[model samples]
Target: MAGKLGRTGRWAWGGLLVVPLAVVGFAVAKPVKVLPRLGPAPIFRLVDADGRAVTHEQMRGRPVLYSFFTTSADDRVGSVMTRHLLALQDRWSRGSPDAASPTPLLVTITLDPERDTPARLKAWAERVGVDPQRWLLLTGAGLAVKLVVGTGFGVYYETPPGNYDSRYVLVDAAGEIRAVYRGPQLDVATVAADLALLQREAAARGAARLAYAAAHWFACYPVR
Candidate 1:
């Protein structure tokens, strides 16, 4: 009788072990969305619409949603991108006031600096109904702008011979490039979701920080 009881206990333990192993196998096989750590954000000097000097160093310790545009035309290139970005700002601000640190800044860097002077940027800001307190439009020397946008951000754009990639780059508070969105993938909900996730990860500490890092390592972004 004692031998039979011991045998039953061993079988029960073995079954429990199989359950955990199966779960681990299933998790390993499951598809997970992961954001690639593109690289460090480029540091550069630029002037905001308010004529304030904003530098890459100043942008550190806060998440920034950055987009490039030229007020040269109201085409899909510039106008469409601005509309989508503004929508993201609205949704994010309304979702939770605490969802972002540094108050969730939206930076619009002008590719056409010669035409996008501070005065021009101020005028454009007025036309677009931008709340300068939240949204910032920046312009600087041609070479500096080109280096920051093209070489630093990995965005392709050229002057005189016009070519541009309409995209948005999300930089985390730690100044790391986390994700890029463009085309049909650009949407307020998606941007907002990513922002919230990154903010939570940024604010985490101790074991929580470890968990967030693990999620990044495992590429745990949600499927769109």
Candidate 2:
């Protein structure tokens, strides 16, 4: 009886080890990559350059990359963010279009809404030569913009905006904020990688979903 009990204990331990080993393998191999779910995106209703109401509900099924900018000419943060996003836009557009996945939207919300009118935004979009359909330049009421930029995104904003930090929020298709990127420098490749991972994670199902879920838990994102 003692011998039989010893054998059962060893088997139980081996069974436990198998699951852990598999988990370790999954982490190391990283077959299906995913970005961590940050939190629920702030509910917002802002207008675009075309004077159309662009609400959170409208953005529900599409991934949106959001940046806050001011019309201030000397705004260095804005310059860097603008260039980075333009590069991303070019890169994304040049790639073979994927009909299965929803086309991503790039949004730049002006911090100086008092002056950054819809017409101003439209002119800026044209000046930059960005595809107006894919990239939207947005401006709205002062209180509304403040609410979305400060309360919603938790970024600093003051009138006559003197140098707001460069930050980008990546909100996923299901209306969840997946990643927040900060700093003056932008890595287009890494951002591209993260976006790809997000699109893949969104379409994952069955065992693939489970693996992606695991990656979402363990991975810090921008995983190759």
Off by over 4 Å in 2: 1-13, 27-31, 96-99, 219-224
Against the true structure, whose TM-score is highest?
A: 2
Task: Please report, in order, the local distance difference test score of every candidate based on alpha carbons.
Answer: 0.78, 0.81
> Model 2, range 1-224, lDDT digits (tens) per residue?
99999999999999999999998887778776667887888888889998999888888888889899865567778877888888878877876245678878898899889878888888878887879867888888988888988888888866777757668998988888888888557787777777787777778789887877787676835543
TM-score of 1: 0.81
Quote the lDDT for 45 in model 2: 86
Tell me the deviation in Å of residue 212 in model 2. 1.6
Candidates in order, TM-scores: namely 0.81, 0.86
TM-score of 2: 0.86
User: How many residue-pair clashes does candidate 1 contain?
Assistant: 2
